[model samples]
Target: MDLSVTGDPVLAQDETEVHAGIYLQKGTLTLTRKGKDFVAYHALVMFASANATPWAAQRVKFTATGPDSKAVEVTVDLLNDSWDGPRAGIAEAIWKVVALAATAAGDIGITYAPPGRT
Candidate 1:
């Protein structure tokens, strides 16, 4: 469950979770799972201006495209230099953004034809 920039991080089978970040150096990161496929919805970046420090933000939305199509979103905020403690709102914001994006992608495809039908 721990993701490192140096070592290869793999997902656990029994676990349906994912983490996002950039690799400091060139390395191969493996995504392991018991019987599920991993899909990344989008990537986010937060950087500072020239006069300021650099900050990074990454968000990955995973949807199980197998027998069960369950959707879950994960967001990782990288603080430049100084490490900021984790915040609950961060995760919430991530999910909100993911949901909005998904909704905007297309219609729900639920049409009400009623008894008469069209």
Candidate 2:
């Protein structure tokens, strides 16, 4: 694949793969911003890349909920970007629900066990 940077330069390129053909990017994206105080809380970026169809995209589709039961989906377009996917581990939680890190498939979604009840 041919990748290039215009102004800024790429720091490093990881040969590691989160999935099959996905690689982590070790670089900074150029920030062309104006003089304005755009108050923000938190932000996230996700990228997905794969050659195989059908199941490839599914692996990157990390879905979650927002403040008001709103559906929040984060995933990179494997076909479009033709690059790496999101961070190796996609962690998302629903509003009012504690989405713990991936321990097991059973420990993915919301928990009704309460704190320290497990």
Candidate 3:
């Protein structure tokens, strides 16, 4: 699997009011299973709201190449909008994309383990 985070989140500042501000982020992920490869495009947008302090939405599309390839795409609003931290939020999003890609790959018998685990 290859994952590349092309766009790092650049938060806009609100000098007058304290808020998380707004930003746009992007990434690409590729996973291979059973001689097939799936490529996913990820996009995220953090929006500024007067009523709410901070909020964000994310979308990912997985495109596959194989005899039995299937495409999976999803969009979620208010995903990890809180102050839990960027690492946690991004991890959650990445896992979601991975799961979606795996599902789209069909019965290729693909399984995943943590790094350094066999």
Candidate 2 lDDT over 1-118, as tens digits, reads 8997578754322311222222112121111124322221222322122342211222333243333445444443322244333233222321112212111212212122222234
List runs of model 1 lying over 4 Å from the truth. 1-37, 49-51, 54-67, 84-118
lDDT (0 to 1) per candidate: 0.32, 0.26, 0.36
Model 3 Cα lDDT, one tens digit per residue, 90-111: 3454544434443443233333
List the lowest-lDDT window of 10 residues for candidate 1.
Answer: 108-117
lDDT for predicted candidate 1 compared with the true structure: 0.32
Candidate scoring better on lDDT of 1 and 3: 3
- On lDDT, who's better, 2 or 3? 3
- Model 3 residue 64 CA deviation in Å: 6.1
Ranking by TM-score: 3, 1, 2
Q: Tell me the spans in candidate 2 whose CA falls farther than 4 Å from its real position.
A: 1-59, 77-118
* TM-scores for all predictions: 0.25, 0.19, 0.26
Task: List residue ranges in candidate 3 displaced over 4 A.
Answer: 1-28, 31-37, 41-52, 55-67, 74-118
Cα RMSD to the true fold for all candidates? 20.1, 18.1, 15.8
The digit string of per-residue lDDT tens for model 1 on 6-88 reads: 77865333322223322212112112256544344343322222222222222343322232444444334533235442233
Model 2 reaches what TM-score against the true structure?
0.19
